[model samples]
Target chain A: MTLTKQKNQLPVFKKMSTQPWSLLAPLLIVLLGLFLYPIIEVIRYSFTNLRFGRIEYAYTLHSFKSVFTDRNFLDMVRITFTFVIFSVTFQLINGFIVAFAIYIGEKLKLKGSVFVRTSVIISMAIPGIIIGVIWRMMLDESPTGILNYYLSLFGFGPVRFLTDPKIALISVIIANIWRGTANNMILLYAGLKTIPESILEAADVDGAGSFRKVFSIIIPSISPVLMICGLLSIIGTFNTFDMIMSLTGGGPAGATEVLALSSYKEIFVNYSLGKGSAIAAIILLINIIMAMIYFNMNKKVEV
Target chain B: MKNKKTRGKKVLIYAIYILTAIFFLFPLFWTLCLSMKTVPELFQVPPKILPKTIHFNNYIHIIKNTLVLKYLKNTFVLVGATAFGTLLISIPAAYAFSRNKFRIKNNMMFGLLIFQMISPLVIAIPLYSYLAKLGLLNNYLILIMIYIALRVPFTTWYITGYMNTIPKELDQAAKVDGCSRIRIIMSIIMPVCVPGIISSIIINAMSAWSQFIIPFILVDKGEKLPLSVGIINLQSTSEAITTHYLAAACMISVIPMVLLYIIFQKFIVSTISGSVKG
Candidate 1:
C-alpha cells in the first residue's frame, strides 16, 4: 500500500516539473537566440582579424594584440576608471546629503519640501540626451550663453566650458550628476522612509544630537540601501555612454573618452570590429569583477 | 522662551530652504527664459534673464523644421510595442519562476540576473554586426526585438518578486474550479497583479522612450530615428545655435514625458521607492 501511494506521487511530481518548463521554454529560446547568440558571436569575433570585408572568413589573435598595444588604449582605461570613481563618489555624497535634507524636511514639516522633492523627481524623468543638449547650449562660451551671460553680470568673462579640455570632462560630469543624482536620492529617501519613526524618537529622547543620531543610528540602518545604491551607481557610471556622446563626443583631444565611447568609435566609426569587441569584452569583464568583489565583501546584504 | 527659539529656528530653516530651491532650479529657470529669445537677442552682451518678447513662433518653427510629430509618433510606437512585448513574455516567465519549481530553474534565474547586470553597450557592437548581416538594420522591428531582449531579465525579476507576494491558495482554488493554466493566469493571476504590471510598464516605457545609445548605433536613417536621436540631429544641423529653437525643441521633447510623470507621479514614485527597498 505504501509503495502504491509513493508510485502515484511520482506522476504529480513529474507533472509539476513539466509545467514550469512549458511556460519557461519559449522565453529561454528567445533569450538564447537573441541575446546569447550575438554575445557569443562577438566573443568569437574578438579573437579574429575580422574587419570590413573579411568578417565571415577570418580567425586570429591579431585584433586582440592590436587593441592591447594601441597607444591610446591605456589612456582610455585611465579615463574610464577616473570617470567611474569620481562620478560614483560625487553622486553618492550628493545623493545622501539631499536625501537627508529631504527626510529632515519631511520630519519637521518644512514649507516647500514637497515642491523641492517633486522637482527633484521630475529631473529623473528628463532624458539624458536632452539634458546633455540643454547643458551644451547653456554653457556655450559666447557672451549670450546662459551660463556666460550670468557670469558677465557679476563682472566675469565668458568661460570656455566645453571647448576647454580641462573643463570638458567636468562639464560632462555635471550633466551626468544632474541627470542621475535624483535616482539615488529617491532610493535613499525610500530607505529613510522605511526606518521606523519610533527609533528616531527614542534616540531623540535619549538626548542624541542630530549628528550623533545620524552616525549611530541612521547610517547603520541605511547601510544596506547605501551598498545597493553604491553598486548601482558604480555600474551606471561605468556604463554611461549617451551623455558623454552628446556633450563632448569624446572631443577636445579625446579628453572625455571613456571605455564605452572608445569601443563605440572603434567598432562603428573605425570599423575595427574585432578590436571594438575586445574592448567591449574587457569592459564586461571589469563590471563582472567589480560586481563579484562587491557581493563577496557584502554577502549578507540582500538585494 | 522655548517657543521663541523654535520660531527662530523655523525662520532659519525657511531661509535655507528657499536658497537651496533657487540653486537647484536655476537650470530649468534659465532654460525657460532662453526659450523666449530669438537667435540674435539670445546672444546679447548681457544674457537675457527674462525675454522682452515671448517668441511663441520659435515653437512653431522648431516643430516645422524638425519633423517633431514623426519623432513623437516613432517614440510612442517603439515604447508601446516594447512595453507590451516585454510584459507578455516576462509575466509568464516570472510566474513560472516564482510559483513553479522545476528542472534547471535556479540556473535559468541566475542566468537572467547576470544578463540583467550586463550593460547594453557591451552587446551593441555584436548585435549591430549581426543585424547588419541579416539586413535588419534601421528597422523598427529590430529595435523592438533588441529592447525586449535587453529588458526581459529585469522585467521578469520585478514581476516575480510581485508574483511571490500573492498567496498560492488562490491559484490552487482556481485550478480546482476547472481553470486551465492559461485561464488561471489570465483571469486569476493578472487581475491581482495589476499594480506590478503597471509599475513594470511605466518603468520600461520610460527607459524605452529615453533610450539613445542603442538606437543611435543601430538606426542609420533619419526618418526612423526616435525623439532622443532626432532632437540631437536637429540641434546639430541647424545653421546657427538658436537658443530659442533648441529650447523650444527641448520643451516639446520633454512635455510628453513630464505629462506622463505628472499623471502617474504617485504610482511611479512609490513604485520606484518600493523597488529600491525590495
Candidate 2:
C-alpha cells in the first residue's frame, strides 16, 4: 500500500523544486539569525578589544595573543583534557558494564532489571545544577560528611573532596561520569540488543565462557558504539560548566577551571569581551571539528 | 551441581542490581533524609543516619517564603515557550524533510547536527552580545527565542526521522483528497507520530529545565531567574542557610521532572531507541 504512494512521490523529486523551502524557511531563518550570525560575531569579536559596556573598540589580535600566551589558558587546556579523558574513559567502561548486566539479566529473565534500569535513568532527569548541589552535599569534606564518614569507618581520615586542589578535579570528573553514564548506557544497550542473538547463542553452544564471549564477540561487534560513546563523552564533558560551576565554581585556587568555565568567567566575571569571545571562538572551533567527525561517523548522517 | 551454579548466578545478578540501585539512588535518598532532619541534627558531632522525626517546616519555608514558586513560574514560562515554539517550527520542517524533494536536504541535516552537538554554554558568549545589543536582558522573550532556535535543529532532526517511518500513502491520500499541506501534516502525519512529537517535546523541556549559563547570563534579576539558576544563587550567597532547608528546596525542584519520567518512562525509552535506530 505504502510502496505505491512512494512510487507516486519519488518521481516528483527527480527535479529540484522550491516547494519545500516554504516549510524549511522558518528553521533556516532561525539558523541564520541565531546560530550562524552569532558564530560570525564570536569570530569577529575575537579579533578586537571589545569590552562590555564600552562602545569604543578596535580590531586587533591583542585578545588572541593574550589568550594564547596566558598561563591560565595553558593550565585550563591541561585540566580540561584531564577531565574529559577520565570522564569519558570511566563513563564508557561503567556504561558498558551496566548495559551488559541488563542484557544478561534479560536473557536470564531476572525480575529486577527494569528497576535497575530505572534507577540509572533517574539521574538523567535531574538538572545539572541540582546534580552539583547534591554532590556537594554528599562530598562534604568534614568528619561528618557522608562519604567521609563512611571512609572513616574504613580507617581513612576526613578527605577534602572539593577543597583540596588535587582531589577537586577528580571529584568533578566523578560527578560528570554519574551524569553521563545514563546516556552512554542507553546507547550501548541499544547496540547490544542489535547483535544478532543468534551469534551469542552460537557462542553459548560452542561452550564459550561469558568473559571470552564478551571479548571475542560482543566487544568487537559493538566497537562502533563504544567509539561513539567515547567521542560524545569527550565533547559533552568538554562543553559542560554548570555541574562544575555549582559544585565548586572552579574554586580551590582554580584547580577545576576548564575552558568552558574560563570563557564564562572571562565574559561575565572579568568583563573582557574580546578575550571571552576569543575563548568562545576556540570552543566553537573545537566543537565544529569534533561534530564534523561525529557527522561523518554517525550512521544517520546521509551527508 | 548445575542447579546450584544457576542459583549462585541469580544471586550475583540480584547483588549487582542492588548495588547499582544504591549507587544511583543514594544521593537523592540522602537529600531526602537531610531534608527531614532538624537544625541540631544537621550539625551534630557525627551526622545522624536518619532524622528522628520528619520535618515539614523546611518544605513549608521554601515553598511559602523563598523564591521556589517564582523560579517554578519562570522555568515554566521558558520551558513551555521552548517546547511550543520548537514544535511549531520543527513539525513543518520535519514534514518537508521527510516528504518533499530538496536538493540541500542532506547538507541542511548535517548543519543541524553540528549545531546540536555544540552545547548552549559554548554559544552563551555570542548570544550574550545579542542580548546586550537588543536590551532583552531579564526578558523571557529572548530566552524563549534562543531556546527555540537551539532546539529547532534537534527536534527537526528527530521528528523528521519519525516522519520517515510513517507510510507515504497516509499523507498522499490526504493530499489527493484535496487536504492542504497544513491539514495533511496536522491530521494524518501528526496523530501517527504522537509519541515522537511528545518525546521531542519532553526532550526539549528537559534541556530547557537544565539550562543555566544562558539564563544565568541573560536573566540577572532575582525574580526572573529559573529554578536552576535560582537554586545555585540560593546555595552560594546565603551562608546562614541550614542544611535541611536547602535539601528541601532541591527536592521540590526535582520532583516534577522525576514524576514526568516515572509516568512516561516507557514512552520515553521507546521513542529514544526508535529515534536512534531509525
Identify the candidate with maximal lDDT.
2
Worst 10 residues of 2 chain B by lDDT: B269-278
The positional error of residue B67 in candidate 1, measured at the CA in angstroms, is 2.2
Tens-digit lDDT string for candidate 1 (B1-278): 65785577567556656654664566777777777777667767766678888668888887777777788889899999989999889988887877776557656666776677777887777778777889988888878888888889878877887887777767777665667777878999999999889988888888898888888889888888899998888777767536678888788878788778767777777666664443
Among all windows of 10 consecutive residues in model 1 chain B, the one with the lowest summed lDDT is B269-278
TM-score of each: 0.92, 0.95
lDDT of 2 at B80: 93
| Top TM-score model | 2
**Candidate 2 residue-wise lDDT, B259-278, digit = tens:** 88877787667655552341
Tell how far residue A193 is off in model 1, in angstroms.
1.8
Q: Score the docking of each candidate (DockQ).
A: 0.48, 0.55
List model 2 lDDT by residue over A1-303, tens digit each. Answer: 000112343643343223888888899998888878888888999999998889999999999999999999999999999999999999998899888889889988999899899999889899999999999999998665898988888999688899999999999999998999888888788878879978988998999987899999999988777777788888889888899998999988999999989988998889999998899889889999998887666653222
In candidate 2 the C-alpha lDDT for residue B166 amounts to 81
Candidate 2: lDDT of A136?
Answer: 95
Question: Fnat of the models, one by one?
Answer: 0.53, 0.56
Each prediction's interface RMSD? Answer: 6.6, 3.8
